[model samples]
Target: MKLYHYPLSGHAHRARLFMSLLGIPHELVEVDLKSGAHKTPEFLALNSFGQVPVLDDNGTMISDSNAILVYLATKLGRTDWLPTDAKGAAGVQRWLSVAAGDVAFGPAAARLVTVFGAKFNPEDVIGRAHVLLKRLEAHLADRDWVVGTGPTIADVALYSYLSSAPEGNVDLSAYPRVNALLRRIEALPGFVPFAKTAVGLAAAA
Candidate 1:
């Protein structure tokens, strides 16, 4: 397996992190987004959207971070990481939607402004981030993982951006339960970290 990714992209980190947690052996092919590598003809052929984190498993191309996660779990038959039953599957799917929707527009968008100089209203995205965080804090108040008893792809989907939300100036100090959930994910075996930028370091300090 080969993962085409960029270090700073939370979306890319989702695929990379899951592969690590599952102990899958793969190659990391860094796409130089700064130099327009992702938009190149060769790259666009893999994904018309021209995004990082495209997975090539023996020439089978899979794009989108969440899709990659689903493909991996289904292909590997890892029902532990992704439930097979209807209710369990739906539960995980719900959070995956949140990761793509609310989490994307909220915490993930906020970080884009600081980390990549993306043009977005900081106040708006930061507010959205907190809104999502508060909901997550309440949801996690009585549970460690997002979907089920054990950690699933849902947890992995939300981990990258939420853990780095401070970079977006979305302070997480008030959300103890969410912080605890982050800590729990960090302690898991074979866990790989999302690389922090200068903005994130200052926010942490």
Candidate 2:
């Protein structure tokens, strides 16, 4: 398998994290998003969206980080990572949705704004982030992981960007439960730190 990815992308990190955790041996093909490599004809053939983190599992090409997680988990027959039971599957799916929806819009996009200077309306995203963080804090009050007793794809999907909320000027200090959840995910074996990159602005030297 070959993964086309950018190191700084949380979505790309999701695939990398899962592969590392499962000890899946594959090649990493870095896509230069700044140089528009992902928009080239070669990459467009793999994914029309022109996104990073496209996985080529032999002949089967999969895009979207969450979808890739499902594909890999199913292929490996590691249902524990994704759960097979109806209710359990739904719970996993719910968190994946949260990752894509609220998490992406809030922490991820906000980080893009703060880090890369992306045109983000702070009044718009920051308030939404606070609301989402509060809800997550309350939800995680009694659970270690998002869905089940152990870590699942849901946790992998949300952990990257959500854990880096401080970079976006989103104060996670208000959410102790959510912070604990982040620590738990980080304490997992084979965990990798999210790589920082020049997104919207250059980091202070």
- Per-candidate local distance difference test: 0.94, 0.87
Candidate 2 lDDT for residue 112: 81
lDDT of 1 by residue, 1-205 (tens): 9999999999999999999999999999999999999999999999999998999999999999999999999999999889999999999999999999999999999999998899999999999999999999999887889987999999999999999999888898999999999999999999999999769534557
User: Among these predicted structures, which one has the highest lDDT?
Assistant: 1
Stretches of candidate 1 above 4 Å error? 200-204
Q: Could you tell me which residue pairs clash in candidate 2?
A: 115-201, 116-199, 116-200, 116-201, 117-200
- The best candidate by TM-score is 1
- What is the Cα-based lDDT of residue 171 in candidate 2? 76
